[model samples]
Target: MTRQLRTGFLLALQFFSVIPVKKQLPMEKEYITAMYAILPLLGLLFGSVLTSTVWLLRDTTEISSLLLGFIVVLIGLVLTGGLHMDGLADTGDAYFSYQDRDKRLAIMGDPRIGAFGAMALVVAIVGKIILVAESINEASLVWVLLIPVFSRIGLLALFSFTKSAKPDGVAAFFQKRVSHKKLQLVAIVALVISFMLLIWSATFLSAIVLIILLFGFSWLYRAWCLRNFSGVTGDLLGAYVEGVEILLWMSLLFFV
Candidate 1:
């Protein structure tokens, strides 16, 4: 169990971020399930990096909020190596192609980006910048840290509840190995920890609103994925992560 948990943490870091993990690890069912189970902590790590960046920039520099927002977004892209963004682009292209399910999946598997993908990337990136610029402040840095946490929790919930669209790929492979009950337990614990963190920050109202919003969006996104793609894919999951992060940030604008 300890070895599975350790390898799972490394696997999550290796797969999701630019963080280097030199040693190769086994991808057994237990390890893969542990990977999904440990996924939200990956978000916590990202949140720490983002929060530290904001703190350093705000303390030392006089940059405009827009530039700060841009920097924050850039750091995210760098950290994840644009993995989720690529998923967002592929998802956009596939969904907007208006083709059959197989065709849409094929389109998503394509290396080239389409007009819709470009547009989706533009809209998502620009929207994030604007929302972050507007919402960020000293008092709200905690919210920024919590945003990725909630977004990842949403990702975990989506994965636990939804079936994979394809027979093969990262999403399908991991989904096949994961234990639904264990995944649910992890999601509950993550949510509880995040909620407590929010309350600790004295943003009790924000905590409630964010949890409600996360679950609502997760449900809607699952339905959308099932209807459009037959089920979720790695790209779809990535898109959900990106989409929920933005939504969470936007929601913070109301309170921050």
Candidate 2:
């Protein structure tokens, strides 16, 4: 296969979802860099999968909204192999461990789960269900559809704007290759995506303001990651993604 098509944004889809793509052998950092260009689509694609299932459930089955929302969350977990969920857990354990930075980084590297990690996972999972269910009940399910997109927008921003904390972690490779120009392109991509998704929502004008606020909120977390962890890591990226997901849903609860 040609390099352009082979290494294209398909890498992002494969990286973040269960969906298969023709991955070129010996993956290149360039592929990853290129993938960041379309990160919003990754979220949009995932959200499409979610909303498709939701439509099926609502139209064909008699499932309770809360239960259906729970099921949707489960489908998401399966689709992403609980990718960000694991990050959320590890981040929780490491950050709340109260160890010095070095020790905390080491704790994050360990394979075993800590109490804080497990608690974080439980809270995130349950919280997502409640928020999504509320959206479903309000017939504002469109918000859920776009949340995966918004969460990814937040993730892409986090990845582009921050340095990596660990030299050898997965995030480090991309950090090294990402240029100032590339980051500028990525920010534009994210803004365009935000506008597209926001304008289509139920409350159009308020969505414009809300999305700007959301982006601002994500930037604050980027600062926090730098201050707390020294920079971003793969685990930290995942935690940010999950956090943005919840924040978007919660914000919608008030706005939608």
Which candidate comes out best when scored by TM-score?
A: 1
For 1-256, candidate 2 gives per-residue lDDT tens digits of 3564456467776787777776453455566566775677777778888888888897689889799879988988988889899999999999999988888889999979999999999999999999878777565556667788777767777787788899998899777765547756776777676666667766676577668767788888988888888999999999888888787777766776
State how far residue 115 of model 1 sits from its true place (Å).
0.9
Off by over 4 Å in 2: 20-26, 139-141
lDDT of 1 at 191: 93
Residue 45 deviation, candidate 2, in Å? 1.0
Q: Cα lDDT for residue 250, model 1?
A: 86
- Model 2 misses residue 194 by how many Å? 3.3
lDDT of 1: 0.87
lDDT of 2 at 102: 83
> Per-candidate TM vs. native?
0.96, 0.90
Candidate 2, clashing residue pairs? none
